[model samples]
Target: MKTLLSTNLIYSIMAKEAFVKEAADDILRLTEWIREVFEDGGKLLIFGNGGSAADAQHLAAEFVNRFLINRRPLPALALTTDTSILTSIANDFSYDLVFVKQIQALGKPEDLALGISTSGNSVNVVKAMETARAIGMKTVAFTGGTTRPGGDLAAVCDLVLNVPSDSTPHIQETHLWLEHVICEIVEKQMFGTT
Candidate 1:
């Protein structure tokens, strides 16, 4: 039992260390882009599936509410939260069009779209990113390096925060941490707390 727990911790730490080393610059770039979006009166739309969906909602809340400081709420929305929309899209069109439809309706040239997918190949996520691109929205993705360095998601995104891990658990954990880091940096920079 002790060995198992220690091994898990070690793997998680190693994965995070590698990711930090490889993706630090990308993180900074993403933060700057996010800042620009807010300054230019652009909103952020985030989405994903399963655990990634939860992470999307969590990050959007961090942006819309607060991260580490008190400030005005930023404009952000998680496309996964509305059960009515999600089910309606899936039932009416297809599961793959769930996010694509939303993007078509809400995305704009000044907005940004963030997709989270551990495999970096979630059909719905990729499709939505493509739609966002067609609309001129900046696109970003959080994914694991296992799937050809973020698979199709990386190809569509302007920035890809690809965690250096194939393990779903580790990738998801690191993704949450990375999202918080982004929120903290954006919050501080925007509020002049940094």
Candidate 2:
């Protein structure tokens, strides 16, 4: 048991380290873009499915509340948090339109949409990204290596942060780390705090 646990931990760490080298540029670009969005009074709309849904909410909360620096709340909404809206959209239209409907209702051209799917192929997430693009909003995707790198989600997104590993657990772990880093940087940059 101990050996298995240690192996998992080592694998996770090594996977993240490998991804970091390739993703540094994209991470910096994402951070700058987020800062610009906030500076322009634009909100962030984040959505996903399953574990990715939880991640979406987590990232949004960090942005809207605070990550490191204590300052004014930033504008961020997790489309995954409102069950009523999600259920309504899923029931009335299609499960695939859950995030898309929310985007149509709340997204502005200045806003940004982030879709997280470890598989890089959640239908709703992809649809949301496409919708965001159609509306002239920038879209970003967080995904893992799959049969196709980033799958359909990457095709529609303006920027794709594709984690190098195909393992969902490792992908999610790295994603969470990146999310936290983004929050810290964005907070510091916007609030002029360390």
Candidate 3:
């Protein structure tokens, strides 16, 4: 049991280290983009499917509700959070159109569209990014390693942050951490240390 615990801890540390080492530059780019968006009063629009959907909502909440600072709520929306819109779009158009439809409705040239997908190829996320780009919104994608479908979506976005791990668990863990760090940076930049 002791040996097993130690091995798991070592693996976790190694996984985190690999992610940080490979993705440090990408993380900084994301932080810079978020700061730019906030400075320009541009909103953030985020979406995904399943676990990625939850992650999208989590990230939006951090920006809209405050991450580590108490200040005015930032402009951020999780398209995945609205059951009515989701169902209506899924019913009228298609599941793949759900996010795209929302983007068409709410996105503007000054806004930012953030899509999260472990595989990077989620059709809905890709569609939304396409729509965002068509309308001149900046696109950001958080994806797993190079092999996943989500990586394709990352190709379309203005900036892509692909965590180094191919394993879903490790990828998702890194995604959560990256999201938290982004929120903290955005918050601090927006509101200062006070």
**TM-score (all chains, Cα) for each model:** 0.97, 0.97, 0.92
When 2 and 3 are scored with lDDT, the better candidate is 2
Could you give me the TM-score of model 3 versus the true structure?
Answer: 0.92
RMSD of each: 1.0, 0.9, 1.8
The prediction achieving the highest lDDT against the true structure is 1
Alpha carbon lDDT at 194, candidate 2: 50
**For all candidates, what are the clash counts?**
0, 0, 5
Model 1 ranges with Cα > 4 A deviation: none
Task: Supply the TM-score for candidate 2.
Answer: 0.97
Sorted on lDDT, best first, the list reads 1, 2, 3
lDDT of 2: 0.91
Q: Write the per-residue lDDT of candidate 3 for residues 90-190, one digit (tens) a residue.
A: 99889989999999999999899999988888898998999999999989998887555357796689887777667777778778888998888777766
Looking at candidate 1, the ten consecutive residues that score lowest on lDDT are 145-154
Candidate 2 per-residue lDDT, tens place, 1-194, comes to: 99999999998998789888888999989999999999999999999999999999999889888888778888999999889998988888899999999999999999999999998989999999999999999999999984687889878999999888988899999999999999988887888875
